[model samples]
Target: MSLTFDGTVLVPVADPDDGERTAAALAPYLSPSSTVLVVNVIEKAGGAPDKASVEQREEYAREIFERARGPLAERAGSVETAVLFGTDVVETIFEAAVDRNADAVVFEPREGRRFVELLTGDVARRLVKEARVPVVALPEDDG
Candidate 1:
């Protein structure tokens, strides 16, 4: 079967700038009838200090989505936003993709050296390995 982004696409956003870049990267794959769901996950770590409340995280997610919307509007049929609370970010992303019935999950690889990726365990790599649907990893920006 040919690869297609004709259905809903679940895109996980970390911040506004990253969201904008990811949206720009996804432009080529999107069709006029595609719906993009941009999501941000507020990682809940037990006993973590200075963690933002759910409401605060949601607000931040909204801002990121708003910024992303402008660029994605020209590419997709509709763009929506979501904020997810979870301890496991990778799991949350996968769950969201399944729950949304996404045809694909698009995201940029984490910015860091190979050592950093090895230390932190790349989420993008994990997603590609475990996601039930296709995972589209965009290239890192050179600029």
Candidate 2:
């Protein structure tokens, strides 16, 4: 039997080709009738990035997810979207995964080398070691 899962996808852009590919891969494991929650997390501004900062960033993130939703809905059976903000990215993402009971998390790594890998230190690798659920790291496009 296929397990019901809440998909927590952390995306930077809505309608991004890479994000769509990742979602497509994830779809194979999902039930045709399963539901998914796509979460777009916005980094808190330098300071607190309080209510207003949060709102602005979250709104931007929301737009990205909103844009991605159409493709996600087409690829996956059903989908939902959310905008989240936090000072700590790792903590926020991990918490969201647990809170949503996500079967897996698909995200683009902020690289520290070569390109995307140079900025982020293998977040997907770290998550794989720490996350209770599976984590899929999508390849970053050079273009």
Candidate 3:
């Protein structure tokens, strides 16, 4: 069956470059009526000190959104951005999908070494395995 991109889609980006690539990959599937909700999760330390200040992280999230919005706007009816705070990145994305009543969760997996992915509990794997809503991993945009 073909997937429909007529409703709201929740997209999680790891950084500015990820945002740009994801938007490019996802754009082809979206129609002019689709709504893309792009989000960046600020991974909290769960009681310990955070890595970056909240302000800095928020600014970074804005940068990610800005990079993603242009491409998404060309295909989607509207593009919206959110900064999410959570100890578990995948869980935060799932929660956002439920909260937003999203039709699906879309993303382009970030590149990482095998050891690093193993150590960090590979978010892309977890997102697909434990998804609350449908999760679509768009292929990387070579163009």
Could you tell me every candidate's TM-score relative to the true structure? 0.86, 0.64, 0.95
Ranking by lDDT: 3, 1, 2
| C-alpha local distance difference test of each model | 0.84, 0.59, 0.92
Q: If both were scored by TM-score, which would come out higher, candidate 2 or candidate 3? A: 3
lDDT of 1 by residue, 40-135 (tens): 988988568637777788888888988889888988888988888778888998898898888888898757788888876777788889888888
Backbone clashes, each candidate? 0, 11, 0
Q: How many backbone clashes does candidate 1 have?
A: 0
Off by over 4 Å in 2: 1-21, 24-29, 45-52, 108-119, 138-143
Error of 1 at 129 (Å): 1.7
Write down the TM-score for model 3: 0.95
How much lDDT does candidate 3 score? 0.92
